[model samples]
Target: MTIDRCHQVLTAIDKINQQDPNKININGEMIAKELIYGHQMTACLNKYWPTANEYLQIAVRAQHVKRWHIARSTYPEGKQGYLTWRKDLGKMHAELAKDVMLDCQYNNEEAEKTASIIRKEKLKRNQDSQILEDVACLVFLQHYFEPFAVKHNDEKVISILQKTWKKMSAQGHEIALSLQLPEHLAALVSKALS
Candidate 1:
């Protein structure tokens, strides 16, 4: 029954994400960006923390739920804008996930826990939250880092990588080190750490 509820919620989230007009080409197929992002989060969670509970799984899967609805350009063009956009997105994702959980028959307690995880409450002070953060960082490093690196100057790219690295757990760092990033990006990541 619980598993069925989980699947229903996941399906609903995917459907909402499928409405996204923005798309990315993944392995020759055009797919909704957030849909692929959610799949990547799920995959990273499973790979890095196989025993993750359903709450953590749900939170991770909905990490970027309906992200396209909020465009960064809607805010002012600066660090404050980026931060505000990210903060708003986190709250929006949590609220959306909670609504789905409630519709799926999850009790308020369970739904609230999921929302808190999605909001990243407690972060480094909470194990589950930290795990989610780790998965997010791993996903960025594996999939987005190269493109992000290309768009920014080396100093800015390295600074962002440093921030990403600080958010990750030691295990996440291990997984990141094993990833085969392109030569230039890998060098920047290495330089960031040094």
Candidate 2:
């Protein structure tokens, strides 16, 4: 029963993400960006923490649930705007995941627990929340860093990398170091660390 409910919630989250209008090219195929991102998050979580509890698994999958609904352009252009947008997105994702969990017949307590993980409540203090942060950072480094590094200047990329590094745990740093990034991208990461 527990496993069934967890699978139901995960499937529902995937269904919602599949509606993403934005597409990303993956190997010669265009795929829904958020859907692939959810999968990537799940893969990272399973790879690094296969024994993760169901709430953590669900939270990871729902981290960016329907993210494209909130356009970054809707917020102002400064750092404050970016931070606000991120905070809003975290709230939205938490609420959406909570709703999905309830719909899947999870108790309110269970739903709220998963939502808190999605909101990253007590990030450094909460083990599940910290694991979620680690998985997100790992996924970003493995899949998104190259494209992001290509677009931004070295200084900006390094700054962003530094911020990302700060959010990750030591275990996450180890996993990130194990990734086989392209040579140029590896150099950029080295520069960022240095």
Candidate 3:
């Protein structure tokens, strides 16, 4: 079974509160600003918590999962293989967070807050992936393709990366609009392939 992040967050918060009275001092808007744990743990909590606060009874669940068994993907860590493995990490966290919320009855606001956190984290991770590729691509070009593109002082490789970025940025935006998870490139697989 998938672990729920909401429940875990609530548990962590409660545990912290029990340990120290001063930590839970802030309520309302300051509640979100409160820090509960270390880096990876915080990333986990934020990604799974939901946002609906008015009624406060939020339950976020991971109903389904889409996977990329193929092993190669666009970020060119060779396209499908490692890329899928990398995103699976986010899916695991998301599942954990959803379970946590279900146990706590944390309302829509809390659930949404968690979702927002995850989305933000996913974005950062995606950017990091691209940066890794961009750097490698740059070096590769410099050593090999640079001579061809640079003759007449042209930046063919650089321009290609820029254009590729334009497409990626647009794709990211579209997915955001549809509320698709950042790790959800699989949702666009057919289109991407075609």
Cα-based TM-score, every candidate? 0.96, 0.97, 0.27
Candidate 1 lDDT at 156 equals 96
Candidate 2 residues lying further than 4 Å off, grouped into runs, are none
Span of ten consecutive residues with least summed lDDT in model 1: 141-150
Which candidate gets the maximum TM-score versus the true structure?
2
Report residue 37 deviation for candidate 3 (angstroms).
Answer: 8.5
The residue-by-residue lDDT of candidate 1 on 105-179, one tens digit each, is 999999999999999999888889899999999999888888888798999999999999999888888989999
Looking at model 3, which ten-residue stretch has the lowest summed lDDT? 55-64
Candidate 2: clashing pairs of residues: none
The superposed Cα distance between candidate 2 and the true structure at residue 48, in angstroms, equals 0.7
Best by lDDT: 2
The global C-alpha lDDT for each of the candidates, from Candidate 1 onward, is 0.91, 0.94, 0.36
In candidate 2, how many Å is residue 27 off? 4.5
Identify the superior model by lDDT, candidate 1 or candidate 2: 2
lDDT by residue for model 3 over 48-73, one digit each (tens)? 32333211111111211111222335
In model 2, where is the ten-residue run with the lowest total lDDT?
183-192
In angstroms, how far off is 41's CA in candidate 2? 0.3
Using TM-score, rank the candidates from best to worst.
2, 1, 3
Please give the TM-score that candidate 1 achieves against the real structure.
Answer: 0.96
